[model samples]
Target: MGGSKTSLAFLVLLLIGLLSGTSSDAHSLSYNFTINPRPRPGQPWCEVQGEVDQKVFVSCDCDRAEIKYLSPLGEEVKSMNAWETQTGTLRDIGDLLKEHVSDVTPERHMVTDPLTLQARMTCRCEDDRHISGSWQFGLNGQMSLHFDSENGHWRVDHPGGRWMKEKWENDRAVTEFLKKVSMGDCPAWLQDFMVCWEKMLKTSDAHSLCYNFTIDPQPRPGEPWCVVQGQVDENVFLSYDCGGAKIQSTSPLGEEVKATHTWEIQTETLRDIGDFLKGQLSDVILEKHTARGPLTLQARMTCQCGENGHINGSWQFGLNGQMCLLFDSENGRWSVGHSGWSHMKEKWENDRAVTDFLQRVSMGDCRAWCKNFMVRWEEMLKSTASPTSGPPAVQPTATAIGFTIGIAVGVAAGFGIIILGWIIYKMR
Candidate 1:
């Protein structure tokens, strides 16, 4: 079911603030369901929202039996093999709450007059590596009852909840079901979602592309003489074997782009750049490591176009994959990340031709390429069943009954475990 505090709405706001400041390592998943026993003009009898890592991802307009995905991640979830089962679970939970509406509301407020019920279930992996889960139920935005996995007991938050608490606490089956769901099912689902999320990050481009070029002054017979790897949103799309003068596509997008005129131009240009880098590295090795031996050089180019139409670009130079110099493509300024590279930075900063070339390539060619590739990729995906986007959905408030601690921090941090008994869905 769901959980909340004195004022469920207010508690939701407070928890949002706390969650925002939480350490990056912490992750959470939650679902909130709202039910209207007596519907008015256009209000639905039940509605559900599913959130992952604090962002609303999926929602169902139960009145119409329609589901809307709020983000690309949501689309990925919808495409999962278990998606139908997941949605079915949502529908069942909503229906169950509607059927048992009176059991969760106070006797005085159980009249036929219009009344609203809100419940939330959540599970989280905290900064300290502790896993917690909770369930909260509220009527008309006021929290009534909650259950914490740690305590394995139901507590009445409002006097109105006394009747429901007494009824649920005595039922051993209900208690065990809540406990198993919050502690077992929820955490398992969260971990599985995180794995899918990590995979998504590597395969999809949210907004950016990066290319890394590595050149070796002395390569073994079995090694690549020089190579360039292209990545879109951290996903390697293509690789160029500089020594063999071959370009290998690593992804569908990359394979499609290979047929474009720009691909040939890009391959030739990268080969030229690789030669230029090898020359520069030879000079640097002579100056910095005459007695130390051969050194590899690396160049990384990155460009991104944001929602506001701003194109940000940067170029980085390093030795053996250790970053040393950074070039701001917008201003044509060169800087060194490490003091040892200060000499190289000073030499390059004084060359007007080098600065102009770097600036021109980043702002002109790089920006154009990034925008072109992204548009093509988007159009290509849109034509298929790839991740789709939808309008933003409102966030849901979370409430929970915590073990050991009574109110304030404990209750605010607690989240419920969601389980729809009829639907035995396994997260893939």
Candidate 2:
């Protein structure tokens, strides 16, 4: 009985050791550290580099994992275990091993994470005196971690760090500039210009901004003068002189035009005239006219199509050298006559000259009229009696000959009918 009790006590102690070991294994402690930068699209990976406390303790709830060392570059160094043994340190001094080491073959291990949503990292390194294995944090959705030994220290490296930093700086600068401009806090000199500039930007009309400034020339008293005008591009500091109806660009990209004018102002408001001309030619000027001559008047005239399907018009010169003209397209005709005093003979001569000119202008359509005239001539020849020819008047003779032929045919039909009647009566 004593031997049996001792055996029972030994079995109870062994059962207690197994239960305690399973409970410890089920409730193992884990440490997780994260370092998140601001979220940005197209960024490859988020990095986490920090250290953990030395003492290994068991806990159910924790707010944050403790960081033990802060490197010179402000990163944290941490260590963890990969295997379930829990008997050896995973990482030690001067061990450069990346997280998420993957083994493709039985012998070769590559540090890569194919999944984009989650990442599992494990690293190990050994020297003659020290051996280390690192258990890193898991990431989701495709990520990769790199490790390197720099100056006898281990550090995590991000590949796209420099590009991301530059992009961030550029975005910040543009945003700040826009904010300041929108708030109307720009410089005094630029405030007025900004109103137009912002309108151009919103509309995206480069042409309007191409010519924003203007110059108006004033005339001295008692002198007829010309106005000089200029325009400037707001974006580029380019100026164009439009004084001569000519454009001179201040920059290579500036646009220029040569302008011409028919009217000149001697007593009108220079500002008003300048504004008017500017409206007409957006970037042109009106230069002074050194020579003078009689004003030439020209008018645009149109004629409707007539029954002949043609349009016609003519210009008539007057005695005063002015012109008065009337065009009649409805009847395919035109009349041009002068009224100024010269002489009766001269007036008639001038009228004939004008008529001849009209005829020359309408010569293309004259072919139709010529064809009608020839047709009328042919009809007249067939209807009229010959004056000096052998053919004489024979209308009465021709009528008598037709009447005689009709009487002869009637007598022949009557005789043939009588003969047929007599033969029928005899046969009956």
Candidate 3:
């Protein structure tokens, strides 16, 4: 039982030791420093202060403060202000110094100056009383210090340091320098590099307008026609000529006007061909068909108008091999001459009458000829048999001449055979 009691006591002691060790480690690892709520900025008596290892220190005065540390040989170490020093346990102080100073050594020295005596003594502690090769104090009663690993030198984290401001000013200077270097218009080669930039910047409508103006064609037939299709502003114009005739029109607006002058083929000029046409036809008609071909016929005609104002159209005739009527129009008058085919020349002789009629009717000479030809041709077809007919031609018989020739040939063959036999007999 005693042995068991001893084991229990040992276990309890072990647990207590572990708990105490854990608490100590926790305490050493973390620290915080806060301004006394009683002191405010801008107050006459307001001051900043801090402590390290329970050692009180003044960081800054109401007006200003300076902290200074000296080595045993009285060499100045590091100095900063109250707010710049971090207050924490030894482990936290080590970590803080490691963050600012690379390869921080375990040793350090520091000092701070606060103008007010109250602030200087306000920061006091027991843990930081001892000093070995180094010691630390807050600047303006704040901030922290530790040894730099690289040189075993002390460093202070001064929160109010001017490093950040200096860096920002340097950056601004660099940017301004770059701006100066890049000043001025781009090089000419670079300017030329963007040849299509203007086109790219134009609106779609403008692009389309330019393309339309430069690239389309318009044409008119009959005349020595040339067409130009292009845009002017936003409007398109097409121009052309038709056989010396000219018409100008606009699309979308549909505005058009045309004027042309063509020659008049006079009745006298047509009369010469009228008889020739009648010779080719069998009969003719006037408005209506009759057993006799009409002396004059109403004809529908088409005239080809030349630029020189000459009119031309074909004329037709009747089966009797005569010109029964003359269809001709000149200027504006359409005329169906009442003269028979044989009188075509006489009909043409009255130039004044023919001219008057053509002018009054607005029918050209060729138009009149075409009209008259159609009337005559229709009448002739009606009075005559079908156009396909002529006479019922007699078919010649296959004569006995062929039989006679055959018989002659057979007799000649018999004679040739008989002569050959006679010759053979003579040879034998």
Report RMSD (Å) for each prediction in the order shown.
Answer: 27.4, 51.3, 60.7
Best-performing candidate as measured by lDDT: 1
lDDT of 3 by residue, 381-421 (tens): 22221222321121112112323444565565555556545
Tens-place lDDT per residue, model 2, 202-247, is: 2111111111122223322432222222211111222222234333
Pick by TM-score: 1 or 2, better one: 1
Candidate 1, which ten residues in sequence have the lowest lDDT sum? 391-400
Which residue ranges in model 1 land beyond 4 Å of their true spot?
1-206, 379-428
Provide backbone clash counts, one per model. 10, 20, 66
Residue 137's C-alpha lDDT in candidate 3?
Answer: 27
Which segments of model 3 are wrong by more than 4 Å?
1-300, 307-340, 344-348, 359-428
Off by over 4 Å in 2: 1-201, 204-207, 210-245, 255-428
